[model samples]
Target chain A: MKLSDFFRKKSSGSVAKDRLKLVLVSDRTNCSPDIMEQIKNDIIAVISKYLEIDTDELDIKITQTEVDGTTEAVPALFANIPIKNLKVH
Target chain B: MGEVIVVTSGKGGVGKTTTTANVGTGLAKLNKKVVLIDTDIGLRNLDVVMGLENRIVYNLVDVVEGNCRIKQALIKDKRYPNLYLLPSAQTKDKSSVTPEQMKKLADDLRDEFDYILMDCPAGIEQGFRNAIAGADSALVVTTPEVSAVRDADRIIGLLEANEMRRTHLIVNRLRADMVKRGDMMSSDDVVEILAVDLIGVVPDDENVVISTNQGEPLVGNDTLAGQAYMNICRRILGESVPLLDLNGKKGLFERLAEIFRKN
Candidate 1:
């Protein structure tokens, strides 16, 4: 089995696979990957001015979600920020 | 009521016309009355692929523009028990037809046939718009290449936007050997990227070329591409058909020929 596997060509290097992975995800989200990164950064910058967020532990994701009693699902963006301290007004 | 389905591919030359001919012919062979409308207008080719080219006396433009009755332009195919072709006008351009006219035509055809297959022209232009105007379902054909799948993705989005939710994918001209060697995209990759139900995967068979050259559809029981198309037609009727093996597995002929070698 190992010999046959070695003789077989690897499937990961096909250019189509990588390009499709990025493009399809971007398409489903209705935003390009670069735009997504820019949005994430702008969000972090705006929120960080008031509270100290754990930048290393921050998580941002765009996912598909089904709301209550809905016939179809909708795209939802979720962001998790670990707050270390809040600014005193 | 008949279902109007448009066979579309955003990129050209990915076997849209061939699929329309085979699926329509295959359905007809199943004793269902099927009508194939060439919506490509001046770039008509479904008639040739179905071997009904020379018989076209009237075309789609004639039917739409009131030059001829709908029945007067419908070319009946004797090869199949219940098949017909409504060829497109070779002189009139795509602008000659309108979406409203196509919708009205679809309504008129609903009561007359079991399946209405529209052969859509390539590109997301006026031709594509007019082809899809009357369709409630779609079959987007794509090759296993990046460009083809990308274009197919766009077409699927457009189909969904138009509320043609019953969309399926047909991956055409896939070379199984190349796929195994990791040189070409596999069927799974295409279905994953396109995110649609796969209706069929047509193996890259030389018979497709030969049949096209002869102005005939490849539907022989023993031929690989032909058998694949027959399977597609069966699935269109809501039957569960297993996909044909185009990979390294020995086919029936190869296994049977082994007996002769041993003898």
Candidate 2:
């Protein structure tokens, strides 16, 4: 088989894997895509209570990656919270 | 020891009853005394699938209500001598039966049979609770579809909450052609999300429909789906069998080759 054919096959496999991951993550967590989006917004709001953070810089995502032939969904909430400058008295 | 297994699915039409019928038949074929119980009260289908609907003179409610003995309610399968069925009551609702009753019924059959398979009703309601009440282990059935998998996840959570630790998964109604064409979910994809040990994988076979309609299980000889059920039966018996990929093109090619050889 040509290299392009090999890459095409791999890409097809990747697409199926990606779809499975997306569906499975939603199923496993019992959180629909809409719910996940709402959760992200909620997290952003909660973080804003203690720290001034950029909402645009927030990276809240549910992702599934394969490691050692096992697929795992890692739900991570990423944010850049600014530290307040305090003067020592 | 009679192992009480509850075959459950959170979503409907994922083949829970079909799995129970075939697997029960499969085990019976191996000379294991099996008792298949239909817990889907008010919507019972196991009797029809097992071809024992006509033989149901007394049902689970009759036994539970003390109107009849358990032995009188248990219908023996004509095809398999060792296999018996405890058909559900069509007129009664799920509330008519309690978890304690189910557990006691299973306990009564424990010493008589090697396997007690419960055909659980769909949803996480009273029916689901009554089905899983006496189960020593649970077999969660799901199709290779998004909705089915989601329901399976929820069922697993419920099973865990009930403290039923021995849980296995069965992914049914998989279409190999669609999986190959990237139109369906593969077995690996399902297992990854469910995070449970898979017991079996059954392909979408027209024979399943034919047998079900005929009120006969597909666990007879000459059916691909039958062979799959046989494998699942062996696995349930604690045999170390490799998981067969029903969606694998290579396996399909081999099955076709077998047909050609026979011809």
Against the reference, the lDDT scores of all candidates come to: 0.88, 0.85
Residue B137 alpha-carbon offset, candidate 2, angstroms: 1.0
Predicted chain B of candidate 2, TM-score versus the true chain B:
0.93
Per-residue alpha-carbon lDDT of candidate 2 for residues B1-263, written as tens digits (9 for 90 to 100): 79999999999999999999999999999999999999999998999898877888999999999999999999988778999999999999999999999999999899999999999999999999999999999999999877788788889988998999699999898787877777777787788767899998888899999998999998856666787888999999889888665643466778999899999
For candidate 2, what is the TM-score? Answer: 0.81
Distance from true position, residue B111, model 1, in Å? 1.1
The TM-scores, one per candidate, come to: 0.79, 0.81
The best candidate by DockQ is 1
- Show pairs that collide, candidate 1: none
Candidate number achieving the greatest lDDT relative to the actual structure? 1
